[model samples]
Target chain A: MRTEEQANQAVEEYADLVRRLCFMRLKNREDSEDVFQTVFLKYLLYDGTFESAEHEKAWFIRITINSCKDSLRSVFRRRTLPLEVLSEEAAAVPEEHGALLEAVLSLPDHYKDAIYLFYYEGYSAVEIAEILGRKENTVYTWLSRGRALLRRRLGGDCL
Target chain B: MNQLQEALRGVAATQELKEWTRRRLVRERTRRRSAGRKGLAAAVCACLLCLLLGAGGYRFYMSPVSYISIDVNPSLELGLNAFDRVVQTVAYNDGGDEIAARLSLQNMPYQQAVDEVLSDQVFQSYAAQGNGVVFTVVSGDGARLQAGLEGCSGYYASGGHSYLADARCLDEAHTNGLSVGKYRAYLELSEYDPSVTVDDCHHMSMGELQQRLEQCHEGAQSTQGHGHGEHRHGHS
Candidate 1:
């Protein structure tokens, strides 16, 4: 199993990526926090070693996305919440970025993941395809459609 | 940077979440280490218990609790465990060594082993020549010793005598490098002639020892008769 030192180092390096992925998928702080903790715990128990820093970061990305998907699929998370409650929890960023963040969160799950990896994490369509286990063409389509939707929601060329 | 990249950069993880995850990982590692230690301890305990049982079983099966000394011209003893199976064999003379080397008596029941010894070709030849075979059984349990003697006597019904002896004398007999049967004969012969040592008796055949004992008895009887006659004549 990975040592405690390795676990601490992974959490420090990847916590932001995991939290942002969880928030985009689940759209609530409480469930995002749960999946975040679950992701780091899994890293601590994983016995295999990574080939490079890129491989390790890809591992964390895949695991965090999978954990978020599992949390969203749970019956407890299926319960509907007030729109105001969800918007208040999702608005953890600066006031000026809240609108853009909300628009990103509102996209289809596949497009949201593609957009986040492509724009914020600075991954190309090909790299995003590998991380999300999709064809490169599929990732490109998701990113293109996601940006068009974001432009419509914000109603400007700021995207 | 693009506008979206600059906006998304503001939505990073908070300090509280990172701290909570670090504390949780530490707690999980501790729990796993404790469970691993407990599993190791259980495995060690199981191995030690198996070793103890194995050693105890070996001792119970291999230790001897009784002995049967078969003495003719060949003097040897068979050591029996609690189940009356032969666990050891020791020869006190060259003939006995040959007989012991020729027979596979270990783990055989005492009665079957005695039959094997008595029916041996060399032993039968001596018996055929009218040499007396003596069986001396030594055991702490009286009833078991008597039962063993009875079973031994049946093997050589005419040419042998079977009797019980004290277990304590067995150690003394071994110290003098003799089987208990020969040792008993030595004790009797020593009474008649103090010059007769255990080594002399060890080399002597059982037939020679018996003959010498008989001569001693006759000499004592004749002396007593002559003394009584002389005393009666004086009284008259």
Candidate 2:
């Protein structure tokens, strides 16, 4: 039974990570916004007790990714905006790292997601596979391919 | 692209969705709390029902609703737990403990239970004085146990709720082939005679009473050793 204060603290801590993960998966603001609300709502109502804070954090990450995937497969999935238009048109990244965000966003969908989780979230290939519900070898292949793509965009061995 | 980490980390949940999620969470928590309360109440009710049933069963098991009380030198009461089971066979007097040990009547049915008790060698020892056994049978159900006592009815009459019936009557009735009930009814209406000792007449039947009168005449003619007039005096 999480108290209101505890739920608020959780929202404060994980909201950004979940929001960015949603944006990465959806690549469109409207769909991302739907998943953002959905994931946090799920967190607040989770019946199981977590063993530790890390376990709780991992659970939130897994649910956010799964919720994004579910929204993509939902009945409302057909009504979609252009992924290219959103990436080029949405320039909400801060001035300090505008170029990097734009480059990361420009990578292929699978490659970009794998790269984001591996680099930014500090997850190993095995852990990313578990969260994404993919095979470990597949996650490793995605990371390898994604890093090669990011190297081309960075004009250096970014790995 | 290390700055990409900073860029992504700085991203926040939109203000509208945060408010919506919080409001929905509050509503969900309230619903869950109510369901939990209902479950707790149901569990409490079930426990109370179990306890109520348990107490009722215990009360029914312990109550002494029906039994046969046989009182002799050491008066005793045999309690029935069920229709065919003797749950408690205890003595009510001081010598009761000693007499009760000889009784192999526990768990026996009503018909055979009494006969088994009376036949106990130790019980017979206690009744050597012929302080005839007293029997009082009772049942809450409208069942009268007087009939169908079989071979025992001849020796033991349908005594009052409690009656002192001579033990010797059992032997006498056995010898004369008489039912104890018919014999006692006859004795109640017979005349006393000097030939029969007063002690034996305590339970002597009326048929036996007539025999005593005939013996009185025979003794006067036959026995000159004791004066016939003195024998008559003794009888009087």
Candidate 3:
């Protein structure tokens, strides 16, 4: 188990990354908060040592993604929130990127993950494959298909 | 920066979320540590209870509740626990010590221990030379003493006599450095002849004690008969 100081450090360092992953995967602010808290609690209880900063960050990413998936699969969570509620949640960000955030959230789950890792987190296709436990070729395919979908959704050569 | 990166950068964790998660983690770590300490305390309590019960059981099993004294020329005694198993052996004389040295009677059943003593080569040789053997069961519990006498009589019915006695005299018997059987015989012989002492009787064999007791009874009877005849003749 991690000491209190170590746990606080981890929460401070990975809060933004875990929050982004949860927001991308769960969409609902309440469910994202739940997964966010769960991911840090898991970090506190995790006993293994990390090889490097990258390894530690990868561990946090994997745990956060899995936690979000678990939250989405919960039987008690409402499957489809009202559009007004989604709009209210989406209003948390700047108004200029509302369309872009909606476009990203509306993408297929695998494409959203591939695109976020590629464009936002700056992870290579091979590194994403290692983090997501996928074949390198499969990740390359997802990246290609994800970019095409994003181009169509945004209606420009934004890529 | 790409538009997607620019857009996603705006979606970051708030300060409230990080502070809330850190507080909850501290609480969870405290709760888990408390539970671990409780589990360890419970394990230690269980071990102590087992040790206490084991020690109590050993004491009960080793405490003697009855005694069986076998006296031929060698006066030896076996102390039995509640289960009728011998838990102690004592020798009262040099002959008794010699016989005790030749047998392993501890933890044997009283009846089996009697059989072993009666069947010993030295005891058999004494019996063969016309010495009388006596088996005495002494206990505060009458039923147990009766049962012990009956059990031992089966082993040496032909050559030995079986008797039951109270355990109250055991301390006095021990004080005089004698087995209960010898002490009992000493009591009877002292009654017949007040001059008899434990030291004198301690060295006497069971056969010699019995012989002296019979002679005392015979002398008392004859003297009473002769006095009655003299009184009747004077009255006539």
Candidate 4:
């Protein structure tokens, strides 16, 4: 069992990582915050012991992605969020990074997840595959396709 | 990291996000502890309830009662009270209504009630399956009820064309100590393995008998059926 002090430290350390993963997948502040809360609560309740900090980081990344997927598959997401909500989210992002964010979000879910974990979060395709529960080759394919889409949208120079 | 990756990393975890997560985790811990206590209380109550029920059920089960189930064509379950009188008669099928009409079933000893049932032509006509008859005896002393069932039916060669032959097969199986209704399903199967005697099959389980009887040595060996050569045997 984790002590109160340990639990506090975990929230402090992993909150940003979980938040970023959630934001990258969900692409909405409201949904990301909900997933962020869900991910940490699950981590606290998780009974398994970790071998190292890397293992612990992997755990947070995997669970945060799962939380984001769960929110996306939820009835509320299917019923409520659409082009209107997505456009609002696109508008909310900083205008400077607007095209990049739009291009990343416009890619299919798997490609978006792969590209974010690979480029932005500095995860290898092997690590991304482990996090996403896909074959490493599948992750590589997603990354290649995602980069191609990004180049098409933002031009090869920017990519 | 690339320029894009470096810029994205600048989107740091806010103080608000940290504080909110801390508060939520604390609430989750409290709620889990509360749920734990409730679960413990519920488990204790369940154990107590089980103990009480076990004791009460043991007593009711041991009470002196003769449970005579009368099955003619259809089956009728009779629960006899301490006085050996019919207190409850439950019909499992529609044919039981016919047995109820033909037999004066109330207020009789186990044997007497059986005699009363046998006296009815409808009772004689009732073949559980392949003219099989099931008589289960359930007795209790007010703590536990132990039941012994005798299920017997005929392995009719005549495909029920001969009612007497079918009854004889029932008698034959009962004499050999085979469970009547259950083994009736294996009636056609016996033709496959005629070497396995009824006595050999008597104590074997339904599945065992079915499996054993399933082994036909050389396709189907011809045999003298119920009517020919004393197929009817006396119940021991």
Candidate 5:
């Protein structure tokens, strides 16, 4: 079991990782916060131990994915948050890129998951397959399908 | 190339949780540690006491006693371990009539076991005395009492179906509603003896209640057997 101080330090160091995991799935700030707390509470209660930073990151990713899936299953109520709800940083980005990211979120959950893991986290297809409990070929198919859908939705500008 | 990543970086890095949540987790962790330490200390003290008692070799005297009635539904009674006290009296409502029933659940394990059983038809049918039923478990402050009834409804619905499925009808009797009999039970969880008291408010006989409970239990066993054989896998 990690000491409380060590756990808190780990949370602080990986705050951004946790935040991105939540943002990528939930697409809302408040819901992500709830998932984040639940994940840490679970980590503390279960005495989750890791050998290294990569192990910790992988565990956190798995937990985040499970949390998001659970949220989707249990909380079916739609949150009416708008697409332009990002910070001034995202607002400062080119409109075309922003639109592309929005289109990515609109994809089906499997494709969205594959695309996010591929581009955002920079996981290889095989790693995505292992992480998602799917075959490598399935991951490749989803990535290709997701990219094609995005290109189609974003038109010629996506290329 | 990295501009998209940078834009995604800080914007995604919002303060994820409230300060209170962190404080709550810390407090809970500390409390759990302190509680664990206290439990360890208590265990050591108990061992020391036992050692001293053994050195003295003075055997603790015991008494022999018999209970007045072997209450099939003990949760309805009030008293000590023997369930000889009446903590409170209650009259439950079922349909249009007020039936005389009592609630009592003393032994928590018995209550828990009975509740688990009742949550399935097999166990619940056994607890029924005539039209009245007994509740074995009473959780703190009647919280378990409320949940217990809802659990019974689900149990009954499933039990009804399974019971029908097994019966060899002339043409597999297409009866739509058989287990619709309203069950009126008295539930009580006291500081002493906590058990459920079920009287036949519906005037159901001892034989009918037993059969129902037995059939349900049989169905539950078969269902459990089925669940075990088919699916034993979980996410890796």
Candidate 6:
């Protein structure tokens, strides 16, 4: 059981871990915020107890993904927008980087999340699988598929 | 190296997460304390009264006030100052590092108002998002005022300049010249009651404090009157 002080510290130290996980899974900035809040509030209320930092990090990832799933379920009834390009307004993309972000956003949610976590966050495929509650092969498949999709969308030989 | 990574380098998480976390922790502490008490009859009355006021078109529960606070994680503090601009999901600290945020809301009916602010597209586009906030409704006089760091209740703020701090909800104590403190009844999750007994307990001149209380009461009551005025044809 983590003490209040340690719990506070844990939240502070690994907040980015939480953000990265949410960013990968949800794609949209707004839904990501909703999931992020739900994750921390749950951590504070019931799941603050963790045996190790790794344990806490894994827990945050799992909860964040689940929260995204919950939001996805809710979106069945409520009109939902893609997380990458918000429907409320046009994203102000500079002429240079807009195409690249749009390509990343076009991938399936699972593929997009896996690719970002693996390449950007430097998580091993095994670790990504563990956080995502999937097998190693699944993570590999997502990464491969996501990269192919990004390559195709960007129409570049870079892989 | 990847496009996503390149995008993220320029995509900044906002700085307001610190404020959200601070407010959340304090509100969490307050809610836990309130639930420990047994007498919730008055609280139920207050909720009913507010609901009736809303029904009558008083708009008592739809106040636009919001409370915000920032807390820097020692580890994340270094990177906070790098953020370029403020977005709904992003805020930049003074030192220029970025961190995620969490929010604690003391009022439930006002979630719509808060959602309006949080859901803005400019605010929503950033990837560095804060955790979901806990919203609880408490009754009180002041809306947004700087609170002392320790207690979760509202104190008798004397001057005009209240810091732009995370304001807790205060309850009106009808007896003892309307005691100033956090309202206990409106919490879902809490750490402790936000009520604190001041040292100069006797310093509260009943007349002066009562006048203040009456002003607040009249304000709420006047709002209630307006709400009822809206429903005059419906009820009759």
User: What digit string (tens of lDDT, one per residue) describes model 1 on residues B74-152?
Assistant: 8889998866789999998888898899899999988788888887887777655444577777886533443344334
lDDT of 5 at A70: 50
C-alpha TM-scores of all predictions? 0.50, 0.44, 0.51, 0.51, 0.46, 0.44
TM (B chain), model 6: 0.20
Q: Model 1: what TM-score?
A: 0.50
DockQ of each: 0.13, 0.10, 0.13, 0.08, 0.08, 0.05
Question: Ten consecutive residues with minimal summed lDDT in candidate 1 chain B?
Answer: B227-236
What tens digits encode model 2's per-residue C-alpha lDDT throughout B76-125? 56666534357677664455677677667766765677677666677666
Q: Report the lDDT tens digits of candidate 6 across residue range A39-106.
A: 56656554224567776666566556656655643442245343335422115334466666556655
Minimal lDDT window, size 10, model 5 chain A: A72-81
The candidate with the higher DockQ, 5 or 6, is: 5
Superposed Cα deviation of residue A75, candidate 3 (Å): 4.8
Q: Write the per-residue lDDT of candidate 5 for residues A104-154, one digit (tens) a residue.
A: 655656677787777777889987776654567878998888788778877
What does the lDDT read for residue B25 in candidate 1? 84
lDDT of each: 0.72, 0.56, 0.71, 0.55, 0.44, 0.42
Tens-digit lDDT track for model 2 on A1-159? 578877878888887788888777665677787777766666655545666887677677766765665564341223434435455324556776666676666565556678888888888887776555456786889888777766767767554
Identify the superior model by lDDT, candidate 2 or candidate 5: 2
* Models, CA RMSD each: 41.6, 43.4, 40.5, 27.1, 18.6, 23.7
Model 1: how far residue A35 lies from native, Å: 1.1
Candidate 4: Cα lDDT at B4: 57
State model 1's lDDT: 0.72
Q: How well is each residue in A30-146 modelled by candidate 4, as lDDT tens digits?
A: 887887887677666655567689877876776676556557534231354443454443444566776776667666666877887788778899887765545678799988988
Docking quality band of candidate 3, CAPRI definitions: incorrect
Provide the lDDT at B98 for model 2: 78
Which candidate, 1 or 4, has the higher lDDT?
Answer: 1
Compute fnat per model.
0.39, 0.29, 0.39, 0.19, 0.12, 0.10
